[model samples]
Target: MGIEFPKVRVNSLINAQTRNWDVDLLQALFKPEEVQLIRGISLGDVSARDKMIWPHTQSGTYTEEICDHCKSHSEDIVHALWLCPCLNEVWEADTGWSFRNTVRWDDFQKLILHVEEVGLDLDLFAMIIWLLWHRRNQIKVGNSATSLGQIVACARQQLQDYNLVQPMKPATESANLHTAVTWSPPRAPFLKINYNGAVFQDSNSAGLGAVILDSVGGVLASLAENIPLPQTVADMEAAAVRRAIMLATDLNLSSIVLKGDSEIITRAIQAEEQSLASYGNLIEEIRLHVDSFLNFRITHVKRKRNSVTHRLARHVSDLVVWMEEVPSHILPVLLTEAG
Candidate 1:
């Protein structure tokens, strides 16, 4: 099976990623959709200057001249991501994977597409680039410099921590399950919703939330929403999941499962401790909807495992309301744990 990401689809992905309309941030980033756009844009889409991010680290600063900072502009995208001294620490740490010593953007692009293969969160790869730039600016602006030692420490922890990817290594989601004699994999095949909360200046805050779908056998209500300024995104995601659950209840569904990447929300919902008291109102509402479930389950997945759902959340935000009855043949795949 020759899988390919076609041109039209690729542009759509780039447009999705560059939603902010800020060209600079778009420079260092590449998406599965973008791999197709390289040649098209090269022919004639954006100007040659708009393409600075890619060319900045790719061999020559302007395709033929070396940059002043690093004498040899030989540092293309791959070198910048996996090699450059500026980001080496964050790359290995914030992320738990090592770059295989790459030299070109194509190689780096390959990594983005096959991140699931490498057991990494492909969505946050852009965040990695963004952070590297931030770390670089910190040293440049005399904010606070970083060291390789710190980077490695962070990477190992994150690697050991983020278990959203399949083939989950041993990590405890709760203390209650520690003594279980036999470990049967997760049985519930259902949809998962993930949300991120950002507390802005003063009390004004908004969240970026997404709802994703993974069905077992029955119909799944997979969706996402962008809520107005919220107290936080984590809360927003939790609230979103809660809203989805309540909707599921209203639809008269007997069984369903809820998931989010927010540990604070998941832990609070699970223990009913009200951990971060600020989300009291949202959490309380969540509690009410949660009680409506006859056979309901809620849990958390690392940001990595939440990707497909995350992508769908972003795409489906404009369109909510769905009730898709999955094909019978695929029910087994949905019910059983992902291989």
Candidate 2:
């Protein structure tokens, strides 16, 4: 109504079989809180061929069985989520929300804009919309319909969980004047690899070791390798890091955060300038390999914090790899860090 969109246009929108708009336009059109949800609907991948997906179904395709919200009525996203008689109680129960007076029932974008105009929390509104859609699918699968109060409770829990898992902070942590630096785990779904290189000056060789752990402190991988022809300690550090990246890429990890004790290597990796160190070429090589991951991070920690990797490297005067497990020698250090 606000933009003169007709019911025919509404039908075209609901039945639209293509994702034509870019994320920027969708974000501008919807409430700030709704942008992610809307982007999720659009799938955010330009190269992926656009296809119609019924938002209310688990299988992602349309099915008559998913029309449980209103089997007798002409069901669209607007009607199923906003106008269904089954969902009337959900709206009535959330007494604090002024959705009825603020939203224009004819179109979805108008509803989001109106919610923002009324100074409503779009996050909660988005959550309710998500929950309503979620509950509809749940009912379609033969689960009992969730009550309005249950829906509200679930939304709050989901919001809390989302906040806890956000990895938005800057990668560099400010060093304290006195406190010792320690290793920290990466966010969920990202594997953290603490790696170090040990130079055996007497033998003119170096050994590289890496210990990989998940967010929950579970071991995923470990590598110990001897560089028979070693350069400087910095070169060894660079080689170790590059080896870690190569392994992560081989495993097809989508996200990784690599920690190391070499300040020179870490600084070189983070900096845009080419390293002047003897192993600067190795650092550049590591950076190039990092592009293979959807997300990658390299951070520096104190040597004491990297004790486990130091011990592992000491053992690899020979080359070896342990997949899905670490050797018995690394157990004490791993246990302390896991705690």
Candidate 3:
């Protein structure tokens, strides 16, 4: 049975003398495979010293006790790792971990089975379970449990390493390649807004910048502001788009073209793809705001063509806003695009 569980509980259950145990309780509580293991272990001599061994540890020993999480619930495979109070903390620490509310899970097996039914990534679920178990063990051994940051970092690194070791998927190649194109002004009477977000990972800060231009590339308004560092690049990009929409709406801009370099954001806005990523809530908010505009379209532009907005996004300072003009530093690039 492929399920998430701790090793110590398994050891204790297998090695314990269960002559007076209720067979019905055993069958009801465990899977068929687990029940078989119970029967086999019951046959072992009671005098045999019951030793708990965890292969990963140098001592090859494990401790069985109440849950380190709640210190109240019995420390069993299901309770210790998943049902404990710490479960929510671990999941909330990483923004990437989310599940649909329509589905319910009372146990780890039920959760895994539901994920499979919904075609969720099995590998990701397995990795998260492993990390949770590892975290639990750390706490049990008198070591502090790792932060959500550390757990997420370890999981991401392991996934990246695994991908690197595997063979790459083939890319579709076209015989004809098109030349790069610069950003084109929107149709007359429509205002164009170019936006980008820059993430300073080391500082855990992000900058969002947006430039509003008329049909002829004349700067109407431009603004740059700092935002809380989002968990992923897509989140930052989506935030930039959301801010642009809000700003444009405030100015009563009826018709607008919003452009960004991220294809993922573009697809999400166009409804061509599902908004199921870490930035899904932002994507949903963007959609609601799009309806507020008289006319709005989200399009993808190459990074080079988006230089003006990109440069505006590079900062780790307080929020700054410019109206009816471009910043002095970005004026040259603005003139170039306008020319």
In candidate 2, what are the lDDT values of residues 1-339, reduced to their tens digit?
A: 233323223223332344333444444456865543332221111132233333332112344433467577666666777777666666776666545645445435435645665687789879989998877788777888777668777887898899889876443433342223444667976889889876553454567889888977788898888764343445567778877777787788888998987776787788886555455555556777777788888888877788888888878557688898878978887777655
Error of 1 at 193 (Å): 6.8
Q: Give a tens-digit lDDT track for model 3, residues 114-214.
A: 56656866776677678878877887787877764576567767888998998754443221121224446789668999999876544556788999988
Candidate 2 contains a number of clashing pairs equal to 0
Which stretch of 10 consecutive residues in model 1 shows the poorest summed lDDT? 42-51
How do the predictions measure up, each by TM-score? Answer: 0.39, 0.46, 0.47
Error of 3 at 132 (Å): 31
Candidates ranked by TM-score? 3, 2, 1
For each of the candidates, the C-alpha root-mean-square deviation to the true structure, in angstroms, is 16.4, 21.8, 23.7
| Steric clash pairs (candidate 2) | none
Query: On a 0 to 1 TM-score scale, where does candidate 3 land against the true structure?
Result: 0.47
- Which segments of model 1 are wrong by more than 4 Å? 1-219, 316-319, 325-339
Q: What is the lDDT of residue 174 in candidate 2?
A: 32
1 against 3, candidate with superior lDDT: 3
